[model samples]
Target: MRSFYNSETGAVSIYLIIILVPIFFLQAVLIDFARVKAAEREADTAARAAVRSVLSAFDTELQKYGLFGLTGEPESSESLFSMIYKENLSGSSSGGFYKLLDTKPEEGHASLTSLYTLANHTVFKEQILEHMKYTAPIEFVLEITDKLQKPGAVKTLANGSAYAKDAEKIEKLLVKREELLDRAWMETVKLKEELNGRHHTYRARITELNRLSELIGLNTADGVRSQIKTLEEQIRSLSDSISSLNGSLAAAAAAGPEAAAAIQGMMDNMRSLQDQLTELQRRLSDLKTLLDNIVKYTGLLAATKLEIVSDDEKVQNLQKSVQELLGEAKKANDELNTELKRVSSAAGNELKVFEAFKSLKILSEDDFRTYQTGIASSAAMFSGFRSGIGSINLFTNANAQKIHAANDAYQAQMDEIYQKQLVIETERNKRNETIRKEKEKQRSKIQAALDRARQAMGDCGTDQTAGSVSAFYETLEGKDGLYGKYMTLNESPSNAGGSPVYDLEGKPDTEIQHAMSLLERLGQTGESIRNELFVNEYALSLFNYRTYGREVDGSGQPKPLHAMSEPSGHKLPGQEVEYLLYGFNSCAKNRSSAYGEMFAFRFAVRMVEELMDPKNELLQAGSPLLVLLVSAAEAAVKALADMDSLTDGKAVPISSKLTNPLFTFTYKDYLRIFLLLHSSDTNLLARLQSLIELNTERTLDHAVTYIQGSAESSVSLWFLPGVMKLMNGTGISSCEVRENRCRFISRADLAY
Candidate 1:
């Protein structure tokens, strides 16, 4: 029993079974797991790569065709999957795999099927298909299958089986031929349809051409009539103008001498009147002096009572002085009357010249009416001409269509000729194949015969027998007979000749070339379209610029203000004025000091307004500081204006004071005070007060400290101290001393 248990075979068998079974199971499990993992990874990678590849292809196609932003069903997910399928097939090296896969649509989901078959020769095959179905909330499904084969399995196939290969080749060739024939037939049909359409168009073109010709003739006749009418009207207008000029010349000649004589007479009478008035003025001066002296003497007499006896002499002198003044006045009045008569006569002569001018007819109402009528008639004629041109265009287009139709028909004929040539080439190839087969059979038969003859000549011993046998062999081989003939046949060119060339030089034959020439003509047509489009764009730009009241000024800069209408009639603040000021400042700031200063003044005023309104957006945005700097520029303009006003008597007192440097200094102090009082920042207020004190000798320390402590402090503290210092330092009495003193003293110790 011990021997049996310890036996080598049984013990070894038990050990082998126990170890091999578990190992084999583990190996199989691992292999399957690895294969499944690899398949899953491959499927995920391929899905992502395929999606990317499809999207890339779609983008490329869109860019090439300039069809960006064009969306349709072709771009949908289902369409993308279809495209991917086709693309994969096209790129695939193995044919069976693609054909085995099925991609189909279901009710609400896409279904894709893939098959994988593994053979025992280490050969692997895989098929993958993807499908997408439905539009709303699109769904997709993918099916993948993999097949693996063990190595060396392929060598087990049966041999001597050429039938399958030959049959496949023949079937493929037949299918190719059928496809080619279908394509050729479709192209031919399309050509025929196009030719028919072109023929119809050509017939219409001929009718249009005839209409255009008629229109041309009518236009020529009407144009000539219009020219003649224009000439007649111009001649009549010239005649009327010349007649009026002649009438005016005659009237001027009649009035010329009388007008000159009257003017001269008036001048002489005015000289006499001037002399009498001068004499009267001298006598009146003497009387006025005497009256003044008498009033002085009377006042003196009232105080001294100085009297003279026999005052008749003095009275007579006074009376004589008065009479002389009266006589001089009378003479002056008579001279004025004579001058008035002469002046009236001269005025009458001038009226005669005016009457002559009034009677002349340079531009008549009838002439104006005729001119307007001509303009209207011209516009109507132009409209008719445009219509005629349009008709001509239609006629020419119809003719072009007819020409195209003829060309297309010729193209069809050429295509038929080419097809016949292909047929001939096919027949020639068949003939060559038959010849090759016959030669091959003949060679085989000759070889067999030589082998039999060699057997017959064996063991024979005679030069003649050997020679005869050799000769027979040579004859059988056709070395000097049929063989040579076969060689010659092989060396010769084919019996069939080259294809015939179509004659394109003749009138009807040229039509084919004309149709082909459309490719080149299209380039010229495109160029013409581009030129017309450019002209249209230019015209549109010009029209828009003009209508918008925008144009370039003398300096080649856009001057929007110049284009704007005048603002005299405008009720609101004119945009033109604002534009002018803004534009001028933009230009003048860089180049002109005078204009820069003016703009600065406006900017300062705007700043002041913003500062006064604390709620103003611009002020809150910190524009007041900029406004203050801008306002400072007003000092220069004000100074110049003040100088001008003082020298030329044009300056108002209020303007002079405002523009004075003292007022500017005072205003700056007031601004600082206001900013300090209203500012929420204590640090800014202290800094501003320090700045104001440093710049000017004004004392703002007290006002600044009070404002820093109390938000309710009045800005009057800033102005009053400065005003008191100004008055005391300048040593000039105030306009109203009491009021000035009260303003300064009342606010002296006031704080918030």
Candidate 2:
């Protein structure tokens, strides 16, 4: 053996044996590793098959709604997975490099690791979208959406609310203007009374002036003549006294010697001379008295001049008062007309201003000129009377012609003054009557308009029986054309509350609240086209609505409707989609809520369409506010009618005009659009599951949509039994193989 070890003859064979033995061990190890890797690959294949098999057992009821959820409990899922896993890995026994000692999956290893229920929002939405890909009416939904998003669509809807507010504001403005007119009328009435009083004063002053003229002329002549007569009498007495004194002096000188002697005895020689001087002085004194009487007559003529001056002053004052009164009357009339014009303009009755006050010009230029001429004539008459009377003498013919001319002038001036003043009075009466009648008419018109506006705003009930608003209605009817009756719904007392009814009885407030919150968010964020179409298709397919039985399909188009039998004893059988929309437990409440929201949306869209019509004069000559309100009211009525027909399984045209090739929508079509509008909303899956569970006896406690599966196995190592045993001792088995597979099974991938 030592020599063989040393010798080269068999050395190479020994060395080759040693090298081949180690190489064979390494090759065996490599083969075992290769077998382990193969087992792992098979495990992976098994896990994938197991998960797919578990997904294949989907809930059939859910599948009817175009949704997918794993059926059965977790244990059942594990059992199904284990069975599939074992089948996939099962091979010919004892035929390969490794013996199939046990094909059974490891205990606790064949499991569904992850699960997503139908309640999962993402899973539910994905399934619906997948289902909708083939069935959604893309062209139709896009058409409706385009119409709703037209130019000024949102502005038009906003204008409806603004219209209501503006109607109320206009009503208030009309009321205030009416009150202002009333106050103005009272003021005008007082001004009219004052003007009439001034006229009366003018007439009275004219009469008094005429009387004073006569009195001054007559009394002045009489008094001056009487005084002149007295003066003449004194002059005559003085002349007689002068003659008597001369005669008496002659008799005393010639006839009475004894008397002369006695008189002489009473006086000396100087006394006789003094007696002659005294007789001459008496004659001179009588002459002086005659001249003084003449002077007194002249003074009486000057006093007559004073009377004429006083009479002229009175005439001037009367003329001034008349002028002032006329001015005041004119000013009052102007103010009244101004107020009338303002109120009429505000009431949209500008032409009424002209019609009402056309003949109410109180003091025209011609009337003022006539008054001035009359006043001037009266002054001239007074001046003539004063001049003629002041120069009157004792003879009746002395100033008779002048007095006659003055009297004639007085008569002519009085006649002219009376005629002109009568004209003024007549005009004043006309103005006053016109103002009174117009005040009543304007008040009635304003009050009526205000009442109509208030009725539109729900501030007051309409008084349909009072007043004649047939013209107003007719005008509105012409403007609205075919939609007139519907537009006038707000004009009725019963429909005063307007649109969007919010009766919340027997409804879950929390659910509705969440639904509304979701709707609000969706409105802000908007829905994707894909999501919108999916929701439309899903709502139309799975739920029974008002006209569910009337659905029919045309070739090459989506089914117009889905037929469904009404479920018995369900809270909402025919209104399942409405419940989904509003989340109400009560069927009636859900229907009401759905109807209200539908009506509101339809009304808004219709209002925009109506406002866009160029022939509608609401934005121009009429109140934009009224147009908006009437459009809403029209849409409400038309929508109700449309709903009636739609629920009766008939299609109604979208536009009131019913244009050629009309775009029509049935109840389900409208519901589809409603779903599209609220695609991201609905907080829906939970409520849907609740309804499904409520309708069925089985509980969908944990319906799964997504799942992760694991499969593990132990394979016998053919070339390394001792090593495998050693590895198993350290909890590191060389025969161990594990594989994991994850899957998200949805309606899109629900293939068996």
Best by TM-score: 2
Write one digit per residue (lDDT tens) for candidate 1, span 301-346: 3322111111222323332343343334334434433433343343
Q: Single out the weakest 10-residue window by summed lDDT for candidate 1.
A: 140-149
How many steric overlaps are in each model, in order?
13, 1
Worst 10 residues of 2 by lDDT: 740-749
In the range 487-509, model 2's lDDT, one tens digit per residue, is 23222222111123333221221
Candidate 2 CA-lDDT value = 0.49
The true-structure Cα RMSD of candidate 1 reads 61.4
Top-lDDT structure, candidate number = 2
Give me the overall lDDT of model 1: 0.29
lDDT of 1 at 521: 26
